[model samples]
Target: MPERSSGRRPAALVIGGGMTGMLAAAVLSDHADVTVVESDVLPRLPAPRKGLPQARHAHLLWSGGVRALENLLPGITDRLVTRGARRVPIMSGMVSKAPSGQWFRRFDDARHLNLVCSRDLLDSTIRTEVLRLPRVTLRERTELIALEGDADRVTGVRVRGSVGDGVLSAALVIDATGRASRAPVWLTDLGLPPVEERVVDAGVGYASRFYRAPASTGEDFPIVNVQADPRRPPGRGGIILPVEEGRWLVTLSGTRGGRPSRDNGEFVPFARSLAHPVIGDLLAGAEPISDVVTTHSTANKRRYFEKSPRWPAGFAVLGDAVAGYNPVYGHGLTAAAQSVLALKRVLAGHALDSPETARHIQRRAARPVGQAWDLAVGQDVLYPGATDETPGRLERVAAGFIDRAVDAGARNPHALRVLLDVMSMERPPARLLAPDMLFRVFLGRKEPLLDGPPLTEAERKAAGL
Candidate 1:
């Protein structure tokens, strides 16, 4: 650990100003003065930033993440809801067709809820909440040049701001940069071994657009999703999220050959071509609010920073820098929130200046990251050209059982409860393999599966179906 001036409070540098970075700053503010460095000038309102290209797509914050956010910034959820974000109950608030091709019953479960809103709103709210802390500051339009330390310990970060280049010395440096982080190169530049990494890309692509919600749908309109079936090559899916201001943030996605196109004329057709046409049918009567935005950066990439034998003492990485998953699973946001909570927990037990603190934080962050990784790749690996390495026997076995679980969940409320728990990231995937859960999957009584989406009469009428 590097020493500051005698009796001077230690300073922390957070590189990135997105959700994960904001949460990290909030937590670190308790122990040190924190400076958040961001390349883009952040918006005061719930508007998009250039750094977050995925903001145009729908984003879900699972109950696990909701709890984490509340823990980090108390009353933030209320603030979000007041600003038009929704707290939607999991199964009850969603009308979804599983990847295995079964429509889930809208079983009510208060325990599993998701925060639904535009990514811009969520980020803006969190950024506002974090910045209000007395000890935290934000440096916008600043570029991170390099880390200023040796392989053993990180002293601070070198940055080039509008004012010109300068070094910001700190006792701790946390990296919260997303999928495009340069941390791996930064680490290697400081004389460490290359971090082990794995990328499972189904060659997924996304095309998203906004639409005005139908007049007949009320404030509690449910999320409608049609998930892709990995067993089918070039799997296609779509979701209609009723976000704030009575608008729908609709996103359509597909693997490799089946990806959606950017042509405005093709957007609705693409949704109609999904495993189900419910999204398209609903959008047929709505008015477009935004042009179609497409992105192809939907790969599940993970860097094994925790496994590196020689981690620097004063530096740690969080969020998508640790792992970025396919957007369809909706676990990236949850995993990042949980990882920040892990950082909070580890910091409670370790001294900030200790050499082992960064290593400990890095390892703790990996637990949540790994959990989300397994869930995403469990299906992604089944795609034909996702990765060169074939699914191991264990992965295959897990997938078979998961398929059985999903089948049971679609028809049985009890099974669905357990499934939602795991899917929402409230519990580890191991919960699905419990003896009782296995019994429920194999022999539990179930309602007959529906032949089509179980849309309520009012919902069907609302879409003029």
Candidate 2:
């Protein structure tokens, strides 16, 4: 490892204090002094911050992400559960309506699960863990103005205080400022060419609200989802996630003309009108806790910085800054966690000042980003008015294979395990393309497809339906 000047600890400056930035700071703190700069005042508790409006919506920490986060911050999952996040076992703990039909009976042997909770709680828990590191300091109410070095290398960032224009410098800089980052322009100011970018907008919109869980069910309710079928002409979906505080976070979404409404009165009816009305039925018995919140920023965007021939040393981008996916896929947080894990791996074997550390880290992180981007954009492109990026022959073949796998999985336990593994991010998508999986796909649905939500009589009575 290259030693810092006079054997002193190197310093790293992180722009943005969101989950990704906080995780980055935590990982970097082990090897250097880290400071996190945030443009908004962070809430001391698991509450909403000004910058993350999406916090009002539901978010899931898939099992793969949970494992990565635990690796980064041990015992964080237990802490999150203690605070209200539910550990929902995959397939078994979910009631899903798929395009092929209802999901089959999930076996107990499933290895993955999803962490269901509000985005605020998830971010706050991560923020708390990162701040507990003694070597990490936070400078809230500060914004990055520009990079402090040239095209060959970035020495630091020029940040203006939220109250004033005071600036600070460090040895390395990380841009985790999210989808709205200005790093491309900052690099251009240093005479670098524009970074390559790709955008696949689905014209997707979201409307969500909080509802107090039904008294009969208490706390520990399973997540219910009515998924959209992209094979259909129009795309629409809904999900009801059991969150902390004995509440359910319900989100309804649509693409193009099928968009859900922001009107509170229309929420239930809109949900009922979805391909499956289970979500609407479940919400009928719950008490509303919040008004409908709506947003329309579900674009799958990627900035190809690693492919840029001349990336500056001592600088890197992570999380939404590198790629922002369609939120409907619920891959944003997981992708961020995966990126942070990649950063830690790269730093463990290389020095921050090494000639190729940043480039190598970016390349490794790109793997997860590419996986998520492909999944999101591939489906989004099929929706009418979603994008003009025509699906090539390869994309169509992949989609057909996935569709077959999903149909098979809905009835075959072996096939379900493969689908669950990929959905949880525990394994790569290629796992579904394995020879065994392909054979299962050929066999197709072994049992009759379910016609509706497979709810037990007890659950039906509890929901007052």
Candidate 3:
């Protein structure tokens, strides 16, 4: 980490104190004085706030994101687990219905594992860690009105406070305001044109609710997922996640006209209609704790800020603000963590005051955005009424390869490990195209696909199934 000269602390101003913003603040705090300006008063515990409606749904911190979080805040995972977040081994702790069919046996190689918890708990834990940094300060109830610089350089930001307009100058300004960000307008105000944009809207809607688990099964229950078959007529999926507080956060999602309903009465029926009814059956005996909460903004949207000819100095955008992917893919937080890591790497080697540093960071951060964009858009484009343009030949080939690899993963442990690595964000998708992986895919599923969830007799009795 670099230090400021003249005994003055270098400052970085962050807009939106959500997970991405807080993670960025933590990374920046090592070398700079940081202040996070948030519009809503953040909660001290694992409670939802007005700003994050998506928190009502189930959120899985993929292994890659978990590693990044641990790197940013050591001992944080232990804290979360201590508080009841479940560490689910990739195939061992998951009962999944894949596009190919039901996944077969779990391999002993379990390096890839996802962290299952509510978005509220995940964000609150990270926020608490970030706020504990002495160099970091948080300004709740403060909103950013506009940028305070020209197209060539960004020196600071103008914020709206109870008193009036206030200016906070800093070497860097990070925008993490999420899917509804106004970074385009802010840049245009600085005499720059709108950044090139891309959208693959599947029009997916989500309906989620929390339920207290059956006492016999308790908090250690495995994650149950019934994924939508995109090749099917209507795209629908359901997930039962064992989150913090010994509860299951179940979400049912559908695309376009097949969207789930907010009617609490229809929730169970919708889950029951999924390709697999395990999630529905499990929910039958549990106690509902929250009403059905629904959201419809599950499109994959990206801004090509890094491609701009003249990116300003001392400014960068991250998280959903840069590229908001479909929540059904569960790539948002992992992408944000990867972006923060890129920022840390860029800042460590370059002078923050340098005019080219922000551009460099933005360019590096775009790598993850591009990868996630490709992954989300590839699947989303298959849905009805998803987009106007068809996938290009190369994209079609890529999707074909992925589909085959997923089919191979249904039985081959080696192929399954490779696929799970990519899905967990620990490895790039290119890993699946490696010679060894390609051989497995060529050979196809090594064993017969399981007829149902691989539950032991004891587990079945415990769930009263």
Top candidate by TM-score: 1
TM-score against native, each model: 0.98, 0.96, 0.97
Measured by lDDT, the strongest candidate is 1
Expressed as tens digits, the lDDT of each residue in 376-457 for candidate 2 is 8878777665667577789888888778888888878789988877876778988988988988899654777777776667
Off by over 4 Å in 1: 1-6
Each model's lDDT comes to 0.92, 0.85, 0.85
Candidate 2 or 1, higher TM-score: 1
lDDT of 1: 0.92
User: Judged by lDDT against the true structure, how good is candidate 3?
Assistant: 0.85
* Model 2 CA lDDT for position 297: 82
RMSD, one per candidate, in order: 1.9, 1.7, 1.7
